[model samples]
Target: MYETFDDTLLSRLNEPVPRYTSYPTAPVWESTTPEVYERHLSQIAKRSNPLSLYVHIPFCKTMCLFCGCSVILNRRPENEETYVNYLCKEIELVSAAIGGRAPICQLHFGGGTPTKLTQDQLERIFFKIVSAFPLDAHAEIAMEIDPRTVVEDEGAKLKLLKKLGFTRVSFGVQDTNAWVQEAIKRRQSLEVTQKTFRLAQSLEFQGINLDLIYGLPFQTVATFRETVHAILEMRPDRIALFSYAKIPWLKPHQKAIKEETLPSTHEKFGMYLAARKLLLGAGYVAIGMDHFALPGDELVEAFKAKTLRRNFQGYTVLPADDLIGLGITSIGSVGDGYFQNVKELSTYYQLLDEGKLATFRGKILSPDDLLRQWVIQRLMCDFAVDKAQFQLKFGTSFDGYFHQERERLKPLIDLGLVSVDPVSVRATALGILFIRNISACFDRYFHKKEGPRQFSKAI
Candidate 1:
């Protein structure tokens, strides 16, 4: 079983670390032209496995002060209509670059608030996706929604979304406490969130995920415990409890929040521990970092079968590797490399209007990178890795290559957060609490560089 770190150890380990969404995180990406992405896609089209698609909808009615995602303050219908049309064009451009329709096994729509679009706007985009790609018969279609946006006509909108092929939906219910919500500027009542969830359940959605943030302005262990109890009462199929990254430095809007109002590190840790105990008591299996799923959930099954995967969207049950990102500030992977679209809407539109792909910069995976990525993903997903499997895949002695890194991890191993031997590296029960620190052991970038903060809190 995993164990907790002492206060001294916890304080020392709480620092910035990459989420490891990708091997070479976005910060390392360099300028990548449309032609390079085009060539990469051409190679990907020859692969046997199908692809995954990620559509970014960077629009929101009201900005949340704690958000770090690229987004526009959109409330106008005409602006949404215009963005929807461009999304279609971007899809077409990507479809062409791949030379034709490719098998897509997973499709996800992520954003500031994907539900902000009108039913008509959503329909138009769904039509484009239907026409552009050949989706596998059992493909996973997921979307992220804001609870405040669709309270007007819940059943009609959800029913329409179901008809359009959405099997999964996540509602952003960061906190149910009114003061906590007010502090973040995303003030949705608990009743509204329950209504949306109940509607989705009645429509028979395959899965429901409730998004919760633990570390935020004015959150206490007792209050968050109440929030967890309410969430458990709803019984969402999955839960993503994230630590709020107060990155006002990167996302300037976050500056509006008073730093003093945020919970202290010790208090925030208590919230996490309490929430985990309650969820486990409610019969949810913790899946990777910041995620939990009930038994029989695909995510839990994927973990058991060792088929789980990590991507820009966090943990995914689908094992599809090639992702085609469509829309502004979107990112995708092709032929072992990652490419990103421009973040600004004006630039994104300018490129797409000229019949160009909106790739900004990218990086191809190096052999060493691939090996390290596999090791990292394995540890992150499975909490352990077999040395034999490592050797079989990479044709190198795992210990021989990562000897220095293995040595560097001795402190964590001694602290009882992780156990490493000649055969395997495993995170104990409480060790999983500091899994990011364990995984960071294999990240070469952090070791190679000095004095730079490009990531969020490890907790």
Candidate 2:
């Protein structure tokens, strides 16, 4: 959505950059062990704010070809029973660590595919969550669904979810183009997506979000235009428009996707502009960097009030002080610490079976980490940071502390992407497109450009 898709600017700015979902990002996490994560969890038990729970469901039947999530394509369907048992054990141990009867305000089930589980498997896992933690009066539960797998049975599944207290559902609709689908091996049809959307709307769902990716193989401005039009017709409550991060070395499945088929930086940028223009025209308010919502959606209201918060999950309406992550390969945050479960399946299971917290790695935020995180979050969500308010919180002059980074903004400043002064720092509409690149100026962890980085291109 910047001023003419400038190839020169793309070349200059496109480099390895974190999505800034977290300052210090995932690559920097270190020196954390199960004992350390457990310590954080125990400490969080005394905090007054309620909890937000992240449950990872890492099972899937097949590959999406373009997925970057931690998932396994389990052919042995019966293994879900064993997986559910282990999840319950983990939840019980974690809940006990939090002193049980802890309050849960938000619950999100994310995965390779949370919906891939059978109805009984889903119920069993849900039962464990409710039994372990007491939810608030209006506790929100959400899950990500794969539209390609939903059928008439999904109607019943949607109804079941509502009965079980889930208020939200997000469907993965990466692209609607047949050729794009073929190139990606997802093969989801527009008709299936329409049916899924209709089913969810007909139920008691409070919100529905459709996930779209901009830089997938075989995706052109022309073909993606039709995809955008088709998505707008569905009129989802929110849209998560993401730029595809091709990290083939990290996600080996992506290695098969030839670079020749992927769109150029300019084309990818143009596709993003086209999609944003269409969504804005259709009355969707841009929520944050990549999310758009209707005027009445909570995200839109939160954005206007400057209360939007970002976590490992994209954008959140709730400013949860603590997030407890359960299940294998999940990440958790408590206070200034972040923890992750064992990535390997067998090891994760063995740890829980031993009645131990399975945290394998983590990092405790430093003073600078927290400060830069605040700056990054503010600039990312609102495209601006109030100099006076920042000083009030951090007890430092914004200009003085960040002067070095401000100097680094010479190119962006010259290109009219951002404007800064003693009073305020703000991004022009064009600048928001380059927000990650601009925010990188303040990221202390990013400069090393160390060993074989896995971050995606900034464009």
Candidate 3:
């Protein structure tokens, strides 16, 4: 077993920590039926609040060996068209459930590669969403892009995306090292990434974010530093640095990588520290666990103003509200409850063909679930929890419910990972590195089933 926070922190951090993207994470989603999801929409309608929509496009041209996300590869073009058609149907079904259009404050497209679809597919999907919902005039629309697959015709695609109201783009650039790229089967060249950024700049997207990863196979501190320097040169509005999660059993394709080639736990920590130092020195502000943005970036500003929030898609400046997820394996949150779509493409398609919503599973937040979620979200986003705020929002004394958790965390406090006061529990600098473990103390599902260690490391 691990001992000592410094000696054991790195290993413990890597020991299947929840992303804390959602409390009682997706693994515990069990009652999200289609009817239940419709009820969630109805609840949102009654609340009459601006909503956030998340569209999951799970198709990709090729699978990166290191990827652990829900994605389908080597799919026919017709499969994409079929998925889009079903997505349109889902929009109509959700719109009808809400009675009329509800204002959307944010819309984000994430995927195996959201840009894998042709221009026409994107247009059809976005147009359908716009027609079915009342998108706020200042709403932020964003998409994730795979630079390797983007074409010269991207100019036209950008024009259409802008016209359709997309204001931000995040491109994946895990590592610039050719050997690391080859090991992960991502194979993206630095030149290609540069070209993509230049093209995006020409198109004048409101914001550009570069997604970089550390701890990939064959990634050294020197190589990663060079990659960061190159990225700084690009001057993206935001950057998200992620630690590579190596889980061969959960994601069997990861077995393609030779385990010996990966960086050691200590080495990975060094890489993280080095990259953070370089970025901070270059005038970027660290936001939450793994994101950084320039001083003027909305995310950085949000953090300073205490408006940062944690969501299914990592960190966001957008406020928490109803989140409607469309497409296979997507999850939605309406504040009142949570719902998830069918994971298997066949199941998703079958329901759509039958004119039925394709929800397969879900969970309604019991009061306990909601309380724990609030605690976890605060810890994840703010590195602390205000006891008074907890009581004010949940209408229950924090001491009454979490008295045992306070006892359980005594050891962490002794280890200097956290400091507890009369009003709040704050994570120390050391605790920030292991925030997930601290947050896990409040997770209802942590002890239910050990299951598979399929998630990413905390560091």
Candidate 4:
């Protein structure tokens, strides 16, 4: 049914796409004042629901050329301390707004690099959080760490993190090839990563995740394969193999990377296919998009049972609830709406010092937005959506609302990339590789002008 792999398959994959982290993704959020954020928080507290907390640490010791996250580079340690104080003030304001401590089921620290915080600062910030929020005894606290920044003495710090109630840790390891490392300006050695891995293991952290990128400057199939093999040997509970999103025009730093040196679309696809085969052979189950987990891992089991969820942090087994984001540039999902803090440090500090919420922009989802979000989230996580559930939740037939998507998917169905029945729509194995494109059909906001070009590739 398909023609040449080049024009038909590979070319199809090259289309610019959204990651579908959210339906009306963060880009759609509009500027909101501190008053609106406080009102939003009050509305959430009234619901008496449990929430997840996402704290952003936007400082990095050095910039990685391939990185697309919002971060400040090479800031002094004093800058970190200043950031922490404002964060504490913001936390206090949120706590007061909530009326009291609300129970939390999940807490995650994502970066620039969360580990850049000194132990004392880490303790102070976390202490305020624990005091302000009622954390479940089985709550999961996770943080992303850069192996290069973590020292041997920080072993005790890892222990302290556990004692402070962190349950999971993730580290970034783009590629093991020295040439690739040199090009990206992130030169973490195997030794440093190994040490961090072993230290986490010794401390008995509940889960460990290793992140690897497939397409980078100077990376060959062989070098990528070696990185995959090394990761398999290390045996992390989870692995995320992401394709490098090369958007040089958007991220000016990336322009330093010669485009000619980057992998071709086909080459990058080959690397993904090869690494996937190796991971499968080693007994890792593919859990939704880009994530692989061992059979015993919770994510793998969740995938099989169809209980997995996809969030801003990628595929997760955690339950969906309100998520409160802290620190600069962090976004939070509370109830049916979303809010984000001020992204710049100066704005973040000024608002907090005045004892106000630092919210700059946010979106309160309309009923249509919520319905579309449900459909898109299901498509992303399960690779399928139940038509009956769509009707039940939205009081509208999926056929009536998404007639265009139905028409669009007809070609994919004919090509055996998807299966459509009255009750459900599912992505075939081939379709899964292009899930971003498939999911985009449900995105209403995606068509609004063109979104920012800084985003990585959909594949």
Model 3, 1-459: lDDT tens digits are 122335365565567778888877876667557777777777667666678999999988878988978889846899888888888988888888887645888999999888888889999998899889888888999998888767556566766777777999999999998888888988888888998899889889999999999988999999999999999999899999998877677778988888899888888888988899999899998888889999888888888877788888889988647798898888888766778898888888888778778788877888899889889888888889999999899898888878888887887797788888879989898777678888987876775664444567676
Whole-model lDDT, candidate 1?
0.87
**Residues 1-459, model 4: lDDT tens digits:** 222346456766567777877657877778888898888788878665567888888889888999888889856888998888888888888989977645888888999988888889889989999899888888888999888877567587778888887899998998988899999999989988888899989988999999999889988889999999888889999999988977766568988888888888777887888899999999999888799988889898888788887777788777747788898878888777788888789988888878889888888899888888888888888899999988998889988888877887776787677888998989988888777777877777765544563456754
| Angstrom error at residue 40, model 4 | 1.1
What residue runs in model 4 are displaced by over 4 Å at the alpha carbon? 1-4, 152-154, 448-454
Residue 180 in candidate 3, Cα distance off native in Å: 0.4
- What would the per-residue lDDT of candidate 2 be over residues 226-272, giving only the tens digit for each residue? 99999999999999999998887788998888889999988998899
List the candidates' TM-scores in order.
0.97, 0.97, 0.95, 0.95
Candidate 4 C-alpha error for residue 338, in Å: 1.3
List where candidate 2 sits over 4 angstroms from the true fold. 1-3, 100-102, 152-154, 450-452
By lDDT, rank the candidates, best first: 1, 2, 3, 4
Q: Which ten residues in a row have the lowest lDDT in candidate 4?
A: 1-10
* Per-prediction CA RMSD (Å): 1.5, 1.4, 2.4, 1.9
Tens-place lDDT per residue, model 1, 1-459, is 323445676678888888888887777778889889889988876677879999899888888999988889977888888889888998888887786645889999999778888888888898898788888889999999887776787567788889988999999999999999899998889999999999899999999999999998999999999999999999999999998877777899998989899988788888999999999999999999889999999999999998889999999988687888888888888878999988888888899989988998988889988898899998888889889999999898988999999887998888788898778989988778888889888988777874366788776
Worst ten in a row by lDDT for model 3: 1-10
